[model samples]
Target: MSDSSFRILIIGVLIACSLTHVRSDASDHRYKVGDVVPLYANKVGPFHNPSETYRYFDLPFCSPDGIIKEKREALGEVLNGDRLVSAPYKLNFRDEKDSAVACRKKLSEQDVAQFRSAVEKDFYFQMYYDDLPIWGFIGKVDKEGKTHPNEYKYFLYKHIQFDILYNKDRVIEISARMDPHSLVDLTEDKEVDVEFMYSVKWKETDTPFEKRMEKYSLSSSLPHHLEIHWFSIINSCVTVLLLTGFLATILMRVLKNDFVKYAQDEEAADDQEETGWKYIHGDVFRFPKYKSLFAAALGSGSQLFTLTVFIFMLALVGVFYPYNRGALFTALVVIYALTSGIAGYTAASFYCQLEGTNWVRNLLLTGCLFCGPLFLTFCFLNTVAIAYNATAALPFGTIVVIVLIWTLVTSPLLVLGGIAGKNSKAEFQAPCRTTKYPREIPPLPWYRSAIPQMAMAGFLPFSAIYIELYYIFASVWGHRIYTIYSILFIVFIILLIVTAFITVALTYFQLAAEDHEWWWRSFLCGGSTGAFIYAYCLYYYYARSDMSGFMQTSFFFGYMACICYGFFLMLGTVGFRASLLFVRHIYRSIKCE
Candidate 1:
């Protein structure tokens, strides 16, 4: 196809995608009601407002570990540390007796019984503390608080709970009456429930519903908890111990043996050179190809990574409308597009410094990989959303607003800044060393080496939860309600454990695979989890998903962004291991000499 025709075709594809995207059902894209209940933990103060508070809590990304740490790390402040955030607290649906509307003397005898019956029926209630809903943490009365029947205490149960049974025919207000931790339970260690003091008065006298608060974290800690997370936290120390013991044994043998095989010409006993760890410093910073292509790629990768993260973090903070839930479609588009600029400038500048090659081509290629695809993908989505009747998408007015921000605000700033840019060579540091003698580096046996094997280990755990992973990605691109934070947190923990275990095991495995070659292989072995992550993402799209056309077109480009991200992570891991291995090799070799 001609260039213009190709462009037009791409545009056409984007439009189709936009239509399906716009048609995406927002409600379904949220947390499902499979195992959810309402509680009031996060926003604990009805203080005096007799009015009830009801908000829907989506459960996407709801995992126990995440709930504990999400805000702790990001916000630098966790407001409700004591309050347990959990679902299945109590969900109240409206029935004949739900409101004051049914409590009047004017009500007929039939109506009064019907309303009372509704009130007596048990239903599940979800907890809404502040703006965010709790996925795991549930509240209970403190140890000292007096015991109240299921009626007075608003609790979120961990395994099973005791609450009023639900009858769909009766009206029940799934609301709490805030109360005091009555002094009746003065004896410590008793299982006392948290109290909810209601603000209602006889004939409605003075104060509003008497509200008070306390969280319900059990005094008991599960040290052996294979279910709760912190168990893994302590196990790391054990892992370190075992690793240390095993490696110490290997080190004892390796050091005593007069083995300098790679460095010698059959000199089994030649005293090894006593040297310290030194990186190939001079050429360390040099571009891989001494050309601009690699430089541009590296730079572009960095830029895209930074921009994408910024948008995601912003979304996490609820900066976007409808909070974090509503911003995915736009966040995906903006993050991808914004990263292009980062990629182009970084790639071009680094390449210019490394190769002293043509800058224009480097810039263009970087832009193409990063910026070009992004624009095309987004444009297609915009068009398709319009066609598919997705009114929730950015409207024309929004488009105008976006363009104005892009052109006037962002573009002008970048253009002006580019003029005063740093020196091309200085932009990237030169490699510390250049090889005066070519050394033949043998490739470590793939499965035999520790690092590669360790890297391989990430596969199993990735497989264990690959189904959930597939769902999450599909939810993001397919524009579905992706609630399920609780389980996702579990998945996240699994991935972490898998990666760490493999990395540690591979450390020993590579060393055991072959002793001397342990240095580089060890790094590669434990660090290559990124590759598996990439493969799985592709597998999800190609094998598991039959996404919409717009999503399909957007998928590859979005995927490449992920791939690029994985590659760098792998690169960093490999680099760290290699550095550590290099140091060890030098240290022991010198000690023997």
Candidate 2:
């Protein structure tokens, strides 16, 4: 390690970072379905008419988001006999027949003016359905067959309607003549899909939900929307408990053994350094002989589990939608860099609490690994996207702006979080001090090392969840339409239970065989099963998929990301256990007398 080499390495990193910023700042968001994009301010170019387009006023803004409908005069001049039955409630539906059974409301002339004025004034929209455009109006048609800027269309409620919103945000507040009567003839064949074609916001004439439901709230109308509940919290708890319970049950059994008890007593003499809490911690800086390695491994695994949950929840809540028009993508790109801070803060602080030397090295490793590679990879992607207009394309300028935002906004936040975490001290107090010297050299063979134990521990759980994980991977990497949170909720709960039990059982078996290096082995043993899952993906390609060329390469890159992510999770677990083991070993060595 000469000075020139270190300087060159620093220079290389700087160049890579500069390139990323230049590319990330040149674009605006390009939203798609499932992206929680905001309702954009309408551009005036389309509506900057010298001559007015015909505008229909006094229309229900709340009428099924899109499609214009009027009353169908029952075959004209025929004698009226059969009564028409309308559906109980309205929903954005497909086809004229699907929208609703029939219109059921009565619209008054006075109500028209107020609703029209409100729609024109404050309502805004986000495009939902990319296939077609949707329009809203609140005016009337003039003599030239043009929609006058301000005029009302005399109509009633329960008119023709369509659901133009799907996988997009719906109006939080707005008004429409619910149960209105149909006025125009939109016959059976012309179908309109009920996805939100755009996002809509409230305005003056807009009626809030309370008032909108006022008329029909009397009877239970079709339920407005279903409640979405996630099982992650409960799942995380089950995961933690199962893992801990198994460890506790094993520890209790091991403590009951007379020989084991004697050895533990013999090793307790390592803690006599006696300066402060820091000195006591320093005694622990060696490999753990007991089950302490498994504990640290479990903690690291928990961190990875929670990280994924946190990110996904934020995405659903609109902070990081998948189709954030590149904004979300850019953020994802830079977030790994920030996660370095979290990893560093968590890893370094934990290890530091063990009273190990080389604090600076540990901190540096914590901050760089993933972030460094992630920055380089994204820059490469940006370069490719610029040269070729890929579907996952990002504008050069937008990329630059993204870089600035990441550097300015995310960098400080991470640093602050890291500092705060460092100051908090270790969350877990060491179970006991380390021994002064390594335990009586065990003659255990190489095959029983942490690697084998960890390998077995992670295999089955990964196998069980492999299929589900793949389907999810496809939705993202294969560019498929997937929006089933209900199913995901169920799957997450199941995985938590499975992974926890498997990790603990495997860790216990290794220790029973008297394997002392269970710390790193325990975590990776359970986590490396992801590598097998990746192998399954390869098999899937050869068997079921018909992907070709770029698709295949993309599949490779996508899986690469998954593997890298999994690698960190595995390694983080290993690192945590190793730190604890190192401390346990040192304490035992010193105190054993």
Q: What is the C-alpha local distance difference test score of each model?
A: 0.38, 0.40
Give per-residue CA lDDT, model 2, range 47-97, as digits (tens).
211011111211233333234443121211001111111112232322123
Q: Which 10 consecutive positions of candidate 2 have the poorest summed lDDT?
A: 75-84
- Per-residue lDDT over 75-120 for candidate 1, one digit per residue giving the tens place of the 0 to 100 score: 1011111122443223332212222210112233443333222222
TM-score of candidate 1 versus the correct structure, residues matched by position = 0.41
Stretches off by above 4 angstroms in model 2 are 1-306, 315-341, 356-361, 379-393, 421-428, 445-447, 486-490, 493-501, 509-514, 550-555, 562-593
- Candidate 2 local accuracy as lDDT? 0.40
TM-scores vs. true structure, each candidate: 0.41, 0.48
Error of 2 at 117 (Å): 52
lDDT of 1 at 2: 31
Residue-level error in angstroms, candidate 2, position 574:
9.3
